[model samples]
Target: KKVEEQNFLIRKRVLEYDDVMNQQREIVYEYRDRILEGDDMSGTAREQLGNVVDRIAKDYLEDDFPENWDLHGLYNQLEQMYPIGIDLEELDIESVNRETLIHDLREDIVEAYGDREEELGSELMRALERFILLQIVDERWREHLQNMDYLREGIHLRGFAQIDPLVAYKNDGFEMFTELMNSIWEEFARFIYVVEVETEDHNGAGPTQPAWGSSSNTSSTAAFSYAGGTAADQPSALAAARAGGVPEEIQGAADYAYDEVEAPAHVETRVVDDKERVGRNDPCWCGSGKKFKKCHGA
Candidate 1:
């Protein structure tokens, strides 16, 4: 009974951790549903592009004085991210303010995206966007789950520092989740701008495949068994005496213990000759009040 209670508590604790992952899974799935429903994603993509441009601008142009900026580095970053075709040396740095630079970069990016749409066609571009976004979200979410598992396993060690383990786990999990969200946005945007669509021989169309797989049948069972000796399987005292005490095999069987048993209401009692066999859930013959499942029967 105590073993059963402990197992129940352990399962409850596992569910608590699962709840966090379940919530994250729902958010990602909702995004996937929107894509599948053919919702417009250009607005979202534009917002993400703005964020990327802002981050790069901050890195290269970190001073009020235009002369202090690294125009070459800024150009390299923009070229790597978008298909902007402008020479840094051709521009007058003093005349090109930050607003002008941002506006020009945004125009180039928008044109690059428009070119891709023209090449792939609107329908194909929508499908590609959905595929890329879903793939990035799934891959990053899987990595995040692995990281959270590692964090949970080691979090209890924080107790040594006089901290509550649960509190530490919650805080670290939240930070990891935030990082995961950022990674999804960055990876999704990068793939969107850079993905190459391969043309197929079939009608000059791009290679296409189903985004998800078909379902399959599955089955499960609850019963469990282990190799070991039960109390009823033990040799009788007279039989043991005749065999020069318990045999090595019988003695070794003592180490194997049953970890669970049915309740008394579900068990049947019987007697054969002068000896009675004990139910697996009954109290042990060794005089311990604990259930046989956790004591000698164990």
Candidate 2:
């Protein structure tokens, strides 16, 4: 029930953004047509149109962009179109955020106007939906990051069983990642299945629902292996454990043994705090009284 309300809120916010994007698009088209016919847009029209163009750039940046992109080619062309006034150079047009934002638009809009969301339509709606999904995906990604980092650096716990320390750490890390995967799966399912679009808004007419379960492309359930490949390629924690990899927490714990990473004999490693130092040393002085060895050791 609470999730439903939250979903509604998310959709409401998305719709508002879509509305803004559409307005910007309408204005851009109006002015673009005038310019094509060799007519000058009045100062008022130019200013309004400029505002719209700015939004196109802004909304695209805030939407579904991939990492690492280049915008130089588009900049040159935009400069030619709006030269002497349009000033198409707004924010980092090539940023991942920008590309994602642009990419989020409908395929038609993308093919029609390229990076410019200056004329909104289905593309604008697509952006709003993607923005919401991306927000959720980001949270999931952060959780995955935690598990990956954990798996990549397991401790040498094999001393107890007289096993190879590296092997022990790997196995431990694999287990940890499996547990993390279960947690991630539960959360992902909850968000996707239980969460409903909000119906009542705090100030506005809450989010309008899509035609019930309309989003076919929304899913975030994949095992991730740290230090192997990208997160998506990872085997779920369960899979890793079955395959004999270490647990995630243990793997992450391994790095604790060498964290202050001694500087080269010449490069003075700054004296980090007691806790930071405990990141590797003996027992930490904290009243928990657990030896740093037992508490946070590799």
Candidate 3:
């Protein structure tokens, strides 16, 4: 009888753990179904864009005084996400407050988005939005499920800390789910602004291309160059965005194209003295727009 009771307890514990994932699965599936139904996601996209901008603002504009704000950092950060037209260097700093900064950023992003929609037309743009959103949600949810399995395997260890293992698992799971949803929004917003549709037949003779492809040697790093970028393209900001920061899904998206370039054989090599070497915290010598520690130093 005692052995049978122990078996029952084990099964009950397993069911309780699975219930957490069950709730999450329901939420994710319902979201996926809505997308599959071909709902107009422009409003959702705008809301997410606002959220991304507000998140950046909160990070760099939290201070009240203009002197206390990091406008350069803010500009660099924004470059990683969208190709906004606002020139921070051109802004009148003394007249600018947090509200002014937010308004300008939002206005530029909205304008850029409008231009993209006009270029692509409403039907095509809507189709692209739905396709991208659904792809991201499905991929992220699959990854989340794997993560939940890993979490469940170790959650029982919390009992050693004199805590209820099941309670700890539930709390941590909730936090992870929240992060997953936020990441979906961030990635979708970033991709929409930069991705472009291209075809193999530039002369318009062959059938339109169904997708884009990228290839690089294992030793070479991949970088995405937006097709419609303006004079605001910052090589430094692009380097920072590509510096091990982007999600794999974005890096390997269907619309992205990259190339591998080998260094010239005739170039001379120079060894710098230790004192002249870039500090780990200093800017990288490669002009990748990231600190040495985060770039080559890493």
lDDT of 2 by residue, 1-298 (tens): 9999999988985574345335534544453344333232223322333333343445334434433333444445333323222222454445435534443322222232322223333333232223223334456546655654454344444467788655554555456545443443333322332222222232466542222122233444322221211112222322223333455688677666566475445656777777776654566666566777666564
Judged by TM-score, which candidate is best?
A: 3
Question: All candidates' lDDT scores?
Answer: 0.63, 0.40, 0.70
TM-score of each: 0.54, 0.22, 0.63
* Stretches of model 3 off by over 4 angstroms after superposition: 1-9, 199-298
What TM-score, to 2 decimals, does candidate 3 have?
Answer: 0.63
Error of 1 at 247 (Å): 61
**Per-residue error (Å), model 1, residue 124:** 1.6
TM for candidate 1 is 0.54
The segments of candidate 2 whose C-alpha lies over 4 angstroms from its true place after superposition are 1-137, 140-154, 198-298
- Model 1 agreement with the true structure over 68-89: per-residue lDDT tens digits: 8888898887776666766875
lDDT of candidate 3 over 209-231, digit per residue (tens)? 22322223121112232221211
- Of models 1 and 2, which has the larger TM-score? 1
Whichever of 2 and 3 has more TM-score, that candidate is 3
